[model samples]
Each structure stands twice: as structure tokens, then as C-alpha cells.
Target: MLPAPSSERWKPLRAGLVDMFYYDQEEFWFHDGRLLLRGNNGTGKSKVLALTLPFLLDGDLAPHRVEPDGDRQKRMEWNLLLGGKHPSPERLGYTWLEFGRRAADGSEEFRTIGCGLKAVAGRGIARHWFFITSQRPGAELRLLPDSRVPLTREKLREEIGSRGFVYDRAADYRRAVDEHLFGLGAHRYEALVNLLIQLRQPQLSKKPDEKLLSRALTEALPPLSPGLVTTVAEAFRGLDEERDALRSLADAQQAATDFLGHYRRYAKVAAKRKAAGPRLTQSRYEQLGRDLAAAEEAFTAAQQQLDEARGELTALEEQRAELEARRDALRADPAMRDAERLEQLRQDAERKEKAARDREDDRDRQASQVRKYDGRAGQAAHQAGTARDKLAEALREAADASADARCAQQHRTALA
Candidate 1:
């Protein structure tokens, strides 16, 4: 197994085919960033590699780039239609390559890039679309709803949804894939694709043919950009012209250096002759430096005293501010007197309410006593009426007794 190209960056994880060529659905996984197909010719190894690698990256259905033998006769449409072996009049297929990398947090991330081809029996390639996605097919994502049937372009687009984009144009698809996978611009990625195609040729290392090897390398090598070449030539030309002027200036500088060397010797001798007077002046300067140092010490002491005084003044100012704040607070004490007056009024009102409640209780008791006396007076009036009725009956009985006795006496006299 080959070592991984890089540990941090994404590398090819697998290539897949869906209803393309002889594959219903298949995957070819890479081991350590490399995959080797070990099968005899006619087993569709080259076809598998051609469809997945440079073709998937570039979305180039050109026969030369899509085929290992550089055969212009072959077409991707034929692969999709299975070279007319199928009974259907139309067909669609997919070819994809998955790239993977280890994240910093030890998780796995993936990107899948592929092209969808639609082919008609006689109309060649009807339409094609390319897709790039972060979703991994056969796991989090599915390119085929059923095990055998591949997804259509519309379904694929819906399936990927916001996780990816479906590209209508090959150039746009190539740009997206290049930016996501290779981190290269269009021109450089094209060169890289060309190199990949050259390296993937069928007979790269089978035989010791120097001519073939030379041709492969020559084709794999990117052609020098004309603009870049011109820019480099102009830069070299300018440097070459400047080199002569630089050499002339260097010669003049050497002449000036020689003259300066002689003048320096003369200057040193004159400096020695002038040193005695300066020595006397240097002693005086030292004395002045000591005096200046003493003056600076005095100034620093005064500055310290001034700073201490300013600090004391700041404290006094803060104390004054606090005193003013207290005075302002004391000025608001009249409001407290008003609060006390309100409290007094509230207490008077509460006492008056208590007296009123006591008066109401006394009135209720008096009304209850009056009601009791009225009941006793009604009983006495009823007794008096009974007594008067008894007296009238007694008087009537007495009159009747007297009348009966007189009647008896009259009857006796008549009998005599």
C-alpha cells in the first residue's frame, strides 16, 4: 500500500459506478490513497478508472481524456447505453469518486464528486449534469433509492439538497470541484488533470520504451505560459541593464574609498594634535555634569513634594464633595416633616373611625332592647282584652238569675 498523500487534506477514498458500463452499482476503494485494479484485459478496469478519475474531476466526456488508449471513437454515451446492448431507448448513469480526510477532532469528513449522463439510443448524449456534495453515498446519502435502479438527475438534486450543488455547465462543475478538492485555479487544475491523464495511460510502465516515456512526460508537463515567460524575460533584461550601471557605480565607490582612506590618515594626525585642549574642556564638562546631577536630585525632591501636596489637595477636595453631598441630603429633611404630618392625620382618622364603630355598636344594642320591650307590651294588651270579656259574661249571668226569681214569685201569686 502506498502511504497517504497527506494526513490533513482530503484524498481519494473510492470510485463508484451506477448503471454505467458493466456495473449495476459498484465501488472500488483505495488503500492508503492508492487503488490497484488487478484483472485481465476486457474486464473493464481501464473503463472504470477512466470514468472515475480525471473524467469525474474535469467532467470532460472527451474520448481522449475519458479513455485509457486515447481513442476518439469511444463515447461516454455508449457507456451509459451499454453500447446498444440494452432494449431501452434511453438510459441514465452515474460515475463518482469519493474523497475523505481525518478531521482535527478525529472524525471523518467526505466529499463526493460525480457526473450524471443521459443517453438516447441514436441521439448520443442528450444531457449531462455534474454534482459535488459533502454527503457520502451508500451511507448518509443514497444515489439509488432501490438497490438496482440509479437516481435521475432531478431526484439526485433533491437528494443532495443543500448539502451540495448540481451544476448545469461542465466549466462551472470543474471550477467547483477544483476549488473543493485540489485547491487550484482553472489553469493549474487543467494542467494537473492533463498530468493525471498522462500518468493513467494504459502503457506507462509496461515496457522500457524511452520514446513512449519521453512522450508521456512531455505531454504531462504543463506548457510554459507565454505571459509568464515574457514577464520573466523583461525582469532579466532590466536586471542585466542595471548590472552594468551597478558595476560603474561600484568602480566610482572604490575610487572614493581610496581617497577617503588617505584623508582619514591625515584627519587622525590632526585630531591627535587637537586632543590636549579638549582634554581640559572634558574635565570642566565632568564638573558641570556633577553639578547638573545635584540640580536634578533637588528638582526630583521638589517634584515629589509637589505630588504629595497635590495628593493631599485631592483628598481635601473629595472630603469637601462628601460634605456638600451631606448638606444637600440634609436640605431634603423638610419632606420628612410633611411625612410626619401625614402620619398624624392618619392616626387621627383611625381614632375617629374607632369611636364611630363604638357608637354604632351602642345603637344596635339599644334597638335590640326596644324590640324586647315591644313584645312584652303586646302580651299585656292581649291579657287585658280577655279580662274585659270575662266581666261582661258575669254581668249577664247576674241579670238572668234576677229575672228568673221574679218570674217564679209572680207565678205563685197567680196560683193563690
Candidate 2:
């Protein structure tokens, strides 16, 4: 008897509502020997092909369970099968096919073949079947002449290459096909499939034969010039230095980008302060100068007035002394002892003397105040004037500096 076929399994790649796109369910199958699929247009035919891909690759289709609707007890079912020789004795060797149908109550019913194989092999020791599809009838099925064929990754690569197909990432390519063709209703999928078929056909290798070497020839090669070698090395070194510089520049640029976010806030505050500073300084300086000048003038006038009052007080004091002398003389006289005349003369003299002394004392106090006020006002005026001048000078300096900075900035921008 012929050796048993290799063990295999099928798992669902994708599944969806059959009634959504079409009135009937669509399905596909991939056997170890052939690929079989059937569906009408707009009936999720290509969708089934996409869904079944993982299953055909012998990968887990329903490795984890997912609840359907709110039913936590529901188990995720896969549309896959196992076929060929049994890997273990407890399981059957053939893959059984199944389909899902919608019930009247909006539930699904799974259908399956109880006995007959989904695909059959020819009656021979080297029997095998390869199921593929094509728009053309005869072109769909390809038969292997014998069972001596060995499949390998390199062989598959070569086969795919011959047919003008490339399987870099099978999953990605399948998704691209499904999305571009089936999902989007474009012809790109059909073109891709056809291209894959063309590429899968066998072809001869084009690599050159390495066995034909010339062993008889023996020759000495000339030495390279030291100068030329040094030049080349220097060039390489220069290139390496340039690459390092570029990497450093890139790092700096990234750091600058990060810092700019913080810098922007600081710059805004600084700009506002800078804009207000000059005008404020100028106004303060002008007001301070006016106040200083006014204070100084008032203090000088007070001092002059105090000096005139002092001179007037000195004259009054001299007059008071003369009157007191006269009163003493009158009191000492013999004739002054006469009652009415002596009393009237004494009273008149005392009154004049007291008035003169009082005027003198008031004038003296006023002079002292004038002196104190003059000193204080002069010092205050000097200080205030100095401060005003300094502030004005500072503002001018700042304005000049700002103008210079703007000019420098413009120059720099121009150069850049």
C-alpha cells in the first residue's frame, strides 16, 4: 500500500453573515492537495478566501473564546478541518467540511458532510489533488505528476518567484489584497491572484556555476601605491567626521525644539517689560526734576525773608535798650519823685520797652527757622536733581542699547 498522506488541519481565517451580502452562504476549503472555494459575485466569496487563509496555514483559528452578543457561555466556532493521516490514533485522518445556515429565529445552524471526503485523490500510489481556482476552467487545477516532490522554504520561494509572486509577509499581503480588491470593489485583487498563479509555476535557477575555476593560472599582483591608499583613507576619515557632525547637529536641533517651548513664555514676559521700561523712566525723570527745582526756589526765598526779619529784629533790640536806659535815669531823678508826673512817665516807658523786646525775640526765632529750612531744602533738591539726572541718563543709555541690539539683529539676519 502507498504511504499515508501527511497529516494536516484547516482553521477558519474569517467568517461573517452570509445573508448580509447574498441570499446564500459562501464557503471555501483548502486541502493538503488542493484549494477549493465557491461563491457568486457579491456573496463574500473573496472574504471567505481571506478568512480561511490562517486555517489553511495550519495556525490556530479560534485559540481564544469570544462571547457572541451577551452570552458568556457561547463559544467561538471555527470553520476548519483536519485531513490526511492521523497524527494520533484517537482522531480520524480525514478533514470534515461544514457550513453555517441561518434559522428562522435568527440563529445559526452548522451543516457538515457525514461521510464523503470534501476533496478526493486519484487512484494511484502517488495520488494527490491540488485544488486552485481560475476564471478559466482548465487553468484552475494543476496536477503534480508524482509524489517525489519535496517542499522547502527555498523551493517555495523559487516557485513563487517563477510565478511572479512574492510572499514577504503572507498576512500583510493577504490583507492588502482583501482590502484593495474585495472590500473596496476594485480589480486589484484579481490581478494580484493571477500574478501569484503566474509566479508559482516552476522555473530553472539562474545562478552561475561556481565549479568552473581556473586552477592552472598563477600570478603575482602588483602592490597598491601608498600615496593612493593614504588619500583614500583620508577621504574615508573626512566622511566619518562629517557623519559625526551631522549626528551632533541633529541632537542639538532636538534639544532646541524642546527648549523653545519654555523660551517662548519667558520671551513674552521680557518683551512686555522691555517695552514699558523706557517710557516709565522718562516720565519719572521729568517729574522728579520739576519737584527738585520748585523745592530749591521755595527754600531760597524763605532764607532771604528770614534774613530781612533778623535785621529788623536787631534795630528793635537797640531801641529797647535805649528806652530802658531812659527809664532808669527818670526813676533816679529828684524831680521824678513828684507823684502824678513820675507815675505816668514810668508806666509809658515800661510799655515801650516790653513791645520792642518782644518783636526782637520773634524775629530771632524766624531767622533760625529760615536757616534750618534753607539747609534741608537745598540738600533735598540736590539729591532729587541728581536722581532725576541719573534716571534720564539711564533711560537714554537703555534706548541706545536697544537700538544697537536691533541693528545687530538685523545685520545678523541679513548675514544668515
Candidate 3:
């Protein structure tokens, strides 16, 4: 009996979709290990697959949404290269796919994968890259759409390596998708997924013609030999010049169309102005004439006012001259000049009288003080003269007593 598959060898299935096109969200579960969607024309099957076109081609989430979702929050859009329209000039919306392994126990193990396109501003394009979630429970499979961790080339390589989706930038994310999903070393898995989309399309998956089916089969498989790829690549090399020429022609055509449109718009405006020029100039001339008439009226009134002002000024000058003559006559009057001199003489006499009164008062005060000092001096002299006479009489009496004492001493000596 064949050994039952172990969990390590479990196949990864593309289980569900969320926020895809107008469906907004749709979930599916495995039925006999397969889920098929069917509808008539104009349903969303093509639109849903278009969302996966970027990833099937090269693991891009597409640069935008494949179809409009009424539930989408952002309004911005990009003219995407791969497919879809989405917001963000850089870092467009994330595309996520969850891979799960179903078991008989009715339990499914899931590993969620999501990525975003990074805008290359200089190139005016974007490229696909993996996202490490910014929210904690760090960069695991399941994360909110908006949650993101800053990641770049080497950082992403290490992350994918750790996630068992090892890759290099040369082979890029295709290898990672193959490794993580199909356990393949090459990117045939991506090409196969693209084939699956076409299989669902009524246009490509119609009633099979035998030879055409054979051709499709050949295209489905990768070339068995490296030399086949080399030959194909060498043949494609010759087409590069033609492609570049076509691109250049397209660019030239676009530029010429833009220039012609701008020139036409400018010419229309110029023609309108030319048509209006004569009327505008005539209206301006009429306005200037009105202004000129008003100015001339004002000039005539000013001239009359100036003449009246000159007459008033002349009268004022005559009045000033008469006042000057009156002033000169007053200056020459002898009576007026004498009255001025008499007033000066009266002021000088009053000043002299005031000086005489002040001097007489000062002399009277000094004389009174001198009399008081002289009376005190005379009384002191009289007392001193009387004291001297008393002293002189007392001295004469002392002299006589001394002479009597000396004579008595001599009489006593003769008696002895």
C-alpha cells in the first residue's frame, strides 16, 4: 500500500480570497480537494484572476486593483503596468494568499503570504516585494493589510530564507513562490498557475482542437534543454532594435499631439483677443475723452481761482505796506522817544532811593551794637582801676611796718 503523505510533504492550496473585485470578500472551502466557480458572461471570474496575474507572472500583487471595489477605502489609482488600479504612488495595496494543508481530522494548517509593489520614483514604475508586518507577533503569516515592516532587498532575502522561501534577487520572488508553494527549485509553478487562469477563461479554454491543444501543451512545459532557451534568446535579441524604434515613434507621436493641442488652445485665445481689440481700444478712447473734458473744466476753474487769489494777495501787500509806514512814523516821534527815556530815568531814581534806604538801615544797626559793646568796656575799666589803688595803699603800709620792726631789732641788740 502507498504510504500516506506526511505533514511535511503536504501540498499548499490557494484556499480563499478577500477584498477581490466587486465581490469585496468571498470565501471558499475545499470540496473533494477542489473549488470551482461558474457563471455566465460578465461575471467576476476574469477580474478575480486578473488580481493574481501579477503574482502568476512574477509575484507582484499587481500595481493596483483589477476591478473597482465599492468597499475600498482609498480613492487614488495608478495606471498599472501589470494590471489593476490602486492607491499610493509608492507601496501599492497588498495582495495576500493563504496556503493551507487540509487534513482528514477537519483541521487545516495555514500560512498566509502577502506582498506589495514598491514604487521606483526615478524609473516611474514599481516592482513587487514581500512585506514583514509592522504589528507585533512579528511578521508572521497573518497580519492586517495596513500593517507593514520596513523591508528592502537583503532584509527581504533573509526574511524569506527564514520563512522557507529562500531566493536571490536575480531569480527573485519567483523562486521564493515556487519554493514555498510547490517545493520546486525553478519558477515552472508560476507559469502553471497562469495556465490555470486561462483554463477558466471561456476565451482561452474553449472546445480543444487537437493540434492547438498539442501546441498549448508544448507551451505549458518549460524547455527540456538549456540550448533551446539560448537559441530562443538569441533570436529575440534581433527584435530589440525594432522594439526600441517602435517605442521612440510612439513617444514622438505623443509629444507632437500634446504640442499641437496646446498650440491650438493658445491660437483660440489669441484670435478672441484680436477680435475684441478694436472695440476695447475704442471704449478706452471714449473713457479718455471724458477724463480729458473733466480735467479741462477743472483747469479752467483753477485758473479763475488763481486770478482771484492774486488780487487778494495784492490787497494784502498794500495793507502790509501801510502798516509799515505807520510803524516808521511812530519810530520818528520825539514825544514818544522822550516818554521812553523818562520811564528809564524814573526806574533809575527808584533803584538809587532803595540803595540809600538799605545803607542807612545797616548803619543804624551797627551803631546800636557798638554802643552796647562800649558801655560794657567802660564799666570793666573802672572796676580794674579801683582794685589797683587798694593794692598800692596796702603795700605802703607793709613797707612802714617792715622799717619799724628792723629799728626795734637794733635797739634790742644795743641793750644786750
Candidate 4:
């Protein structure tokens, strides 16, 4: 059997104060495997951690020296070392770690170092790194090799495409450190861990294992004897025949069901038509008959009114003729020709003629008044007809407005 793979481990070093500068403390160390930090509240326990950023990133130690020159010219230089190896003053490895937060102010207080170191023994080195936080419940170990540098544009492209390979120089150096510390080789443990993490997290990348399902199903069945197989084959043939018969029955049942559904729909439509058709026809015929009868009655009433008007006109004319005849008879009487009596008779006749003329004028004035009243009645009737039309138009507009409001309400509901 193959031996179990070795797991990676990380060990913390010393961490505390080194010196002091203007507003900033010189140095602090928290590397006793127990991340101890000291200072008063707001006195740079966190600043110390920040100052140690270089050390954490490059695993180097540098003195916390202050600028002694007033001109800010030359000052004491801080020399740093990583894993006991002196780090170059120019460049250093980069540290990637999460920070803790200040309990009082809820501020983040952490640091990382950037430094690179070459092994004196001419062999590659692996670095180890981890995170410590007070805000979170527990510590977590970050398992990743130092990022590797690409040799060419094609390699860069490959690394970029793969996404599993480290692309940055600083990340590559850090990952190299981790690989050395964890005894990892060229294999992709980071990618595997990331894949496992993705699987553990709630993501949409999961796929069903159809092959595993098939295997499981096959495994659950018992081994088959030759006779048992033959018998099963025969049984399956018989079952096929039975299945065909059942299929035919099912098809027949389905057909019957479809026919019944169609028949029911047709019957419902037919019944509705049968019930509505005669009623609609009868209603139309009855309405037409009633309209015709009403029109006939209205015509008859109009004719009767016309006849009555004519009769009244004829009676008035007859009364006028009779009055004219009486006046003529009074004028032609023989007593009016006597001499003395003739003058009195003439005066009387003139008075009687004046009275008759006055009566005739009065009758003509009354007839004129009746004609004016009839004209006013016609105008009122026309005005009433116009008012009815206006009322109908207003009703139609109100109905349209109501319909529009209903439609708008329905549209709003649909959107909602």
C-alpha cells in the first residue's frame, strides 16, 4: 500500500517591541507561538503589529531606528533578516495574511512584510504563513505555495488561463516559502484544496455522478444462473405480449376518453345554442312586432289629431260666416230708409257696423295669439329634443371614462 502523504505545518516565531519613533513605537515581537502584544489602550499594541509587517512578509528582523538628523537626511538604517538569513536592503518577500480588529474602536489592526531570501545552500526554500485574529473565534492556516514567476509570455498566458498557478512575483515567493515549510512538491495541492472548498461551499458547480449510480445499481443485483436467465428471458417475452395487450387497451381507453370529452364539449355547445337560438329569434320578432304596432298607433293618433284640428278650423269659419250674415241683414233693413228715422237708423247702423268690425278684429287678434303660442310650443319641443341628445352624449362619455378607468386599473394590477 502507498504511504499516507505528509501534511503541512506552520510554526510561529518571536514577536514584540524593538524601539520607538515619532508617534510610532520602534518594534515589538509576538512570536513566542502565542502572539503576545502589550501596550496601553491606543498605545500602539496594534501599531507594533503593523511595524512587524516586514518581518511577517519576509520573515526578517529589522531594528526600529529613529531619524536622529533634524534635516531628515541620513539616519540609522534598520537591518532585517528572515529565517536567520539576512534580507537584501532593496527587496523583500511579501506576506499575505488577514488582520485582527481593535476591541475598543472596532478598527482593523494587523501587518504584513514583503521580503525575498535566497538559500545559502543553493537549494530552493519553502515558506510558511498563517493568520491570527481576535475578532474571529479561532485561527486559520493558509496553505498555499509561493507564487511562481513565468518564464515567457506563453507561460504567462498558460498560468493566466489555468488560474490555479500563481502569477505575481511576490505571491510566487511567498508560495515558495510555504512549499518549503510544508514539504510540498510540484503537485497542485492549492488547486485541490480550492476545489474541495468550492465543493463544500454552497455553489452551482456540483454535478450528478451517473457512472456511480450505474455502478451502485449493478452492484445491488444478484448473480444470474444460465437456467434463471433463460427463464427470465421467456418470462420477459410473455410480459411483452401482455404489455402489448395492455397498451392496446390503454389506447382504446384513451380514445374513448378523448371521444367523450369532445362529445361533452359539443353537446354543451349544442345545448346552449338550442336554448338560446329560438329565444333570441322570438325576442327579435316580438320586438319588431311591438315596434310596428307602436308606429301604427302613433300614426293613427297623429291622423286623429289632424282631423280634430281641421274640424275646429271649420267650426270657427262657420261661426265667422254666420256673424257676417247677421251684420249684412242689419245693414239692409227697410226702417233705415225713413227721413228722420233714416238718420237715427244710419247712426245706429254705423254703431252696429263698428261693433261688428271690433268683434271681427278681436277674433283675428285671438287667432294671431294662438299662432304665436303654437310657434313657441314648437321651439320648446325642439329644445327638449336637443337636450335629450346632449344627455345621451354625456352618458356615453361617462361610460367611456368608466371603461378607461377600469382598463387602467386592470393594467396597474397586471404590472403589480
Query: Which numbered prediction scores highest in lDDT against the true structure?
Result: 1
- Give per-candidate clash totals: 0, 9, 3, 40
Clash pairs, candidate 1, are none
Best by TM-score: 1
Tens digits of lDDT, candidate 3, 260-287: 9999999888656653543343344445
Q: Summing lDDT over every window of 10 consecutive residues in candidate 3, give the lowest-scoring window.
A: 74-83
Q: Go through the candidates in order and give each one's C-alpha lDDT.
A: 0.73, 0.41, 0.47, 0.42
TM-scores for every predicted model: 0.57, 0.28, 0.35, 0.22
lDDT by residue (tens digit), candidate 4, 1-416: 11122332333433322212122112233352456656677664533443343334333222221111112332112212332344332212222332222334453333222222212223223322222221111122111123422123233233233222333354454454444333444234343322322232212224446664455345434456799899999999999999999999999999999999999999888656554543443354445445555545554554455455555556666766786786577558776567777777667757766765665666565556556545554554555455555545544454444343344344335325
Which regions in candidate 2 have their CA more than 4 angstroms from the true location? 1-275, 328-334, 364-416
Root-mean-square deviation (CA) per prediction: 51.4, 22.4, 46.9, 26.2
**Model 2, range 13-47, lDDT digits (tens) per residue?**
22222211121233344343256556676554443
TM-score of 4: 0.22
After superposition, the stretches of candidate 1 with alpha carbons farther than 4 Å from their true spots are 1-7, 208-226, 247-416
Residue 157 C-alpha lDDT in model 1: 82
| lDDT minimum window of 10 residues, candidate 2 | 128-137
Tens-place lDDT per residue, model 1, 137-183, is 79766776665667888889888888888998989999888777666
Better lDDT candidate (1, 4): 1
